[model samples]
Target chain A: MTFRSTLAALALAAGFAAPALALDAGTYKVGFVTDNTGPLAFAGTSFTRGAELAAEQISGGGYMAVGAKIELVQKEGAGDAARSIQSYNQLIADRNVIATACCILSPIAGAIKPIALNNKVPLVIYGATAPGLPSLPFVYSVTGLPGPAEVAMSKHIAEVAKPKTVAYFVLSDNEAFQGRFKASQAAMEAAGAKTLGVVSVLSADTDFTAAATQAIALKPDLMMVYTTQSPAAGIIAAVRARGWAGLMSANDAISPLAVFKKIGPPLAGVPFPVNFSADASETPKAKGFIEAYTAKFGAAPDLYSAQGYTAIWLIAQGLKSLPGKPSREALATALNKITELEHDVYGGLPMTNGQAGTRYTLFLNWTPDGKIAAWKP
Target chain B: MDLFLAQLLNGCALGALYGLFGIGFGLVFATMGILNAAQGAYASWAAIIAMYAIELAGLPFPLAALAGIAAGGAVAVLVDQLGFEPLRRFGPGNHQAAMLGALITSIAFWIMLDSAAGLMTGQQSLAFPPGSYPATVFQIGPLLLPAMQAVSLLALAVVGGGMHWLNTRTRFGAAMRAVGWDPVAAALGGVNSRVIVVATAGLAGGISGLAGILAGISTANISAGLGQGLMLKGFAAVVVGGYDDIRGTAIAGLLLGVLEVFCAQYLSSSWRDAFAYALLLGFLMLRPRGLFGGGGFTRA
Candidate 1:
């Protein structure tokens, strides 16, 4: 048999076998679409842990709306846009799933959100904070909007940093990320901080020697890096290689401990914002969540995990509110009515209505030793 | 001035790597008229093999590098025998077809190797731990060179010098030149042109492998596409240096590296790649035959 045919057969077998497992009492079938095996796999894995634990907790009678159980069917999106749409379609059509939770990249989620809406499957985005997502009726974003992170960054810079001049570096490949970062730059400029030029680099670029040298020449008091982990690591190395001693601030795209581990001493005093802290065991809920996640996954949870956990919990809450096996319409209605969701899952991020839509976000900064501490704004 | 000097030094150090790979590319073109696209894949395979030997099997660095070079040479021979020989039998007029075949085979090999490596080890950046080598710095006046960079430069010089000697002084080199100057006449004169061709490929592959190993060591990590970008730069360097001129290829490689560094430092870093291509274009327009264009050979 051909490899393609073999793969197809395997997929069919897995799909058939998925529903054979005994369903828990009152368990409402939910589908999870995620990029579990791609460049963003690390984030996906963490998010999956959150979703899995939430599903387990709901099944174990931790919190139920009325008389419904939750069963999650996980599918790997592999970070491809077309694959995510296919996965979402399959979940909605094949599984007859009422709600879908995803931790796929923004572009993939953005494309799949419309499909979810058309199919009447309530879509909850866990990790991605893409701007246009919250505006969609069927789509509910548990993560904060991209604008809040930028605004919080600007506020922090103005209050604590108070640097005379700041230079901006952003990945040119991602239009959504670049647009949000550009707004932050404009805000920084408006807040009486001199804006040096914005340097655009390719997302896959490794060598930062030239970029770092140019930024050094600018002699900015502060440098803002708006990029993901890989390039951010390279940029930090390049900056340190040139012996630049300015304060460095990064956007939420920067992975706190992961970036710190890769960059080591170069990232000393470099501050970046994150939405959740895995190390935070302050509140009972936070502590319990950490213990349960660690027990299940054998590792600490990050922002992705917290967001994933919150997304599933929110979906479960919606599912609980429904009478008897909840339909997609019921789930969508339930999600729309969700006003203030205070869960220990994400340090009690309040979901409130803003001019655009629901705004749910928090900020955390990284210590030099790579500890993620909550950044109180 | 100090920063400029530092950047210049940095550029030269990086350019040496480009020069090393360009020399291999120029060697094959000068000896055999084939633009071996397989050169880059062979280099990557060699580097990965070396990394595997060192990391997985606990082999010494030197042994691992030797194994890598040997593996590169073997792969080059395999490509010549399987890919080039069949096309060469079709006559020189099918050079375009030959180039396309080589490119496809090389790309196929690269993808297979990359996927296999990625699957074998989970998609994680393979890094050499800190202090794998002594972190000493060599300073001469205002110039500061890291020990790793210095070693890389020194290795390049030795390999480059050895290649120059082999090409100019050796009997094999003379036979290869005779074959290139007139293959029919050289064959009639009983100079084994097939052997010469294979030897040239092997030598080029060995050099490329060494370049890959050095890059891996210096960067402390290796990815699937490590050789792809480097190979493009190497090809550009050869074109800018004059396709068949070995020394010119080396010089062009170093010059290109320095240009990239300067652009990254003085101008916008985002434009570094743009600047590198622009320099190549400007140089090509000024000197169509390349900086030292003398050898009558065409490149793809």
Candidate 2:
């Protein structure tokens, strides 16, 4: 025989003798829809990075079996309703991703969720805190809704500030935040705080002079502000600029370090809730994942990253334990079986009411020197 | 009583800032018979540039403010050259067509400027540097006054008084008024109409920039879209006070600001804009000639 024909014969024999694991190797495609390049760009990118890391770990035989790999499809939603729905459809219809994961803003979730439900695609949601959404079937939230977090935060603030009277300076246009304002107010009132008054302003309002002045006039001991980081910073500065000595409290909307950077010293001493902290987490896998993520991404994981990483790992676990080549429905069933998960970055997270239960939020105060420390309740 | 007095002072300070910005809108409309839709964009750009100067370059606040004003003036000159001037040179034959063309061009410039500033901070507003304004409060009898409010009011008075002088006193002021009344007639009477137009635009833009800085100092936050709200209120002031009446525009602006504040204080802050706009709509319906119209400031 010729040398080339002899080599071909040997390769054929070797292929027949190879392990069956090679033949069983397959890829599960997952789509990620998020506001990656828009207003929520930093958050969306962090979520994407975390998911990517989890996919890498799982497919590379570190977190799961070696033969199966996960292929991630990413799309930018820009947090727009129409755009998010379009991106979801394109990912499902065109890319044929078996499942999808998204993060950050609740408005995007509200927009694309109906589409996911009708199409019977298993959609995983993260970070969106608008309440009344945990009941949706086929739509799983890795992070709990805003109701529990705000309630917890309000109770915490009442304990820390000990204010007799609290006023709300809310951005009326943010539907989610606005919707929670009443519940949060009730929570505070129930916690032995008096409701001073509620001052509402448009989201585009740069000058909060009138609103702040009006609120300050009421002599409230604490101000509960609901707005994005940019405007929240403005409102805080405006309130302080008016020489009001009252304490201020806000929700997680104003919690990111980037927000503190924008707000500078004004944000110091202000308490807000955070969903996760790598340094403070006690989950065994969380420490290892944090080190691995930092080693891979060259930055410590934030709340979004932690949640995103957990979300992908959750999906991977479902895919791994499934009996055979998993269909979308089967994968979703496998995911439903995991009532609680030991997260790599956030310790233990339990699922309830068809979604992750409300996790305990950590309250932190920014120090004068730009460091964050846990608040003593 | 203290609360009421404090709210009153707040309204007045807000009014002064509104008037300062209103002057820019009033100037462009009075001179060219075109709505300067980009007026707010100029204010937004000024705030961004001022923040960059103070934060990144570490310039003193006052110097940074001056730099911002200069940038606003430069942009104003560019807008006049690129937008209004072009429309006038190669405009449609009809007056309505020319006005429409100018409006569209001005709005386009506004969007471009707003988008550019938004890109600088990834669509997030930046806080003014600490000490951009005096955070301390000054007590005057029963009223506790914020130092920034006092400073802003004083600055507005000085600028408004200077604007009044420039419009009614100097030979150049007379020339501008004459041109505003009738460009062809002023040209025939030996007035350099082009110089008047360019000078008016720059002066208006500088005033808008100063308003922007003062607003930023007051709120301690400067968003890229700051100018939009200001522009809306300023336009409303111009329409309510009579387009060419500069003093009337200032007074109207102050009135609107005070009214809005009172609405927020007594009614709902959410309804403040609705009430203010409703009042404007009422004025337009009841008296199209405006509160101070027919004074010949813009009479052809």
Candidate 3:
């Protein structure tokens, strides 16, 4: 044989020698739909990475129960709702993916939820935190929703700080943040704290001198801010610049330590609650997860990263439970039945209420030095 | 009341940046008789370039600003040569068509630049360290003002003064006005209208770059959408101030900024944007000619 023909034949032989990881004849494919680009691309990248890693590790170690290889298909949602739905439809129709994972944006998740239900495909949402998802037989959230974070934060504030009065500053432009803030405010009021007043700020407003001045004049014991990093940082800087010494707290939207650092030392003692953290050693799983994530991603994983990693692990766990070659119905039932599953990466979270929601969250507060540690409620 | 005044001042500071941006838009409109929609993209490029220099290259802040200004000027000149000049030879009625082309080209350029930036550096807001400039608050009986706002206002003054000097005191300025008034006449009179046009675009771009750098420093963060929203608001300011009236454009920019702040303070923050557009719509309907109306130029 000619040298070229020999090389080609050798390549073919090598390809054939590799394991075929396709699903069984009767099994459908599993599609991982996510945003690989746009505003929330970072979250999507981590989610895809986590899922891909889990699939590879599990398959390599012979973790599948049915001795059938699973096929993983990935699609980019581009962080647009219409495009997400279109991508979902394409994945469902073409790939026949039995299960799917979705994006971080609540609106996009909400839009895709209906499509997943209609197609009867088990949908796993990893990043979205918007509350009040309608009951769908196939849709399940393995990560903590934004509601619990707010609830936990309010309870912590009322129990620990015991502030006489609280002022709420919410970003009125963003509907999701606004809704979460309002709900948290109601919870705080129910806990017997007097609500000073709610102030609305535009997301586009960078300079918060006026808002800070007004907020200080109210003389509330604590200021609860609900906004994203950019605007929230601006508000914190403005308030800190004016030397308003009242206890400052923010929701998950403003939880990143980088934000506090950017706003400078005035935000030293500011408290905020987050769902996950690299230094939350209250749980034994924190150190190991942090080490493994840092080793893999070259940095300590943030809350988003942890949630993303846990999400794929949850999916893999559910996929492992199927008796025979897993089908769409089998995978869905397996996922729905997951309870108190140990996410080796994230300590242990119970997936309660299969299609409705999940109750799993951890409260973390930022210290003066920017380290986020679990606060014992 | 003190809070209201403080917010208004804060708004004015932001408005000054917008005004500088509007001046750049007005300069292009006055000289070329075509609205350059790419003004914002150029500004964003300037900001991104500055950010890249400061964050990635680890250059000092002033050096980064200089690099940004140079890049902005280069981009403006490039757009004029490649995107605008070929279409400039079209008839005066093609002015609208030329603008549409520039708008589409600018939008495309924005997307390309934004994507390229994102791919090169992972997508996240590039936040600068605060206290890069002093955060000293100047208090006047509860109406507190940031020292940075003072710097912003000062920058606006410099831009205004520089533009005035360029337009009135310099021979090149006279030549520019001559070309703007009648390009055919100026070319016939040996004015080199093409050179004037390119120079105008470059100068306007440099000013826009300065605005972007200032904005990046002031806000402490730079992102892909930096220029998109600013472009619309700047255009509105140009329209309100009168496309040909440079001074009016600057004033209108500050006015819009203060108006947005007041609206954010009293009305819901969500309505602040609506209020800005509403003001623009009201102004457009009431005075179609703009605040300073008179068309003195047409592109040849």
| iRMS of each prediction | 3.4, 2.8, 2.8
- lDDT score for residue A188 of model 2: 88
Error of 2 at A146 (Å): 3.2
| Cα error of candidate 1 at position B186, Å | 7.4
For residues A180-219, write the lDDT of model 3, one tens digit per residue: 7878888888888889877788766655766776787688
Give fnat for candidate 3: 0.45
User: DockQ of each candidate's interface versus the true one?
Assistant: 0.27, 0.52, 0.36
lDDT of 1 by residue, A1-377 (tens): 99999999999998777444322236577899876665666467678878989888887864654345677888878767877777777888855577888855678777887788778778888877666676444788887766666766777777776887988778877776787787877788788888876766776665565566667767898888887666676776667655577788776555535555445556666665555566653567777888888888787777678778888888776665555455688668877777757454544555543112323344556566666666542
> Could you give candidate 1's per-residue lDDT for residues B64-110 as a string of tens digits?
88998888788778877877777667644665666676666666665
The per-model lDDT (C-alpha) reads 0.71, 0.77, 0.72
Candidate No. with top lDDT: 2
C-alpha lDDT of residue A42 in model 2: 47
TM-score of chain B of each: 0.90, 0.95, 0.90
Cα error, residue B43 of model 1, in Å, equals 5.5
Q: Which model scores highest in TM-score?
A: 3
How well does candidate 1 match the true structure in TM-score terms?
A: 0.77
Candidate 2: Cα lDDT at A271:
76
Q: Which pairs clash in model 1? A: A26-A69, A27-A69, A210-B264
Which tens-of-lDDT digit does each residue in B1-300 have in candidate 3? 766677778788888888888888778877777667678767777878877787679888778888988888888898888877777776245556766776676666667766765664365555455645456878788776677778778878888778868877999878887887878899998999999999999988988887777776666556665666678888888878877777778888899888877776677667778888888888777875578756543331
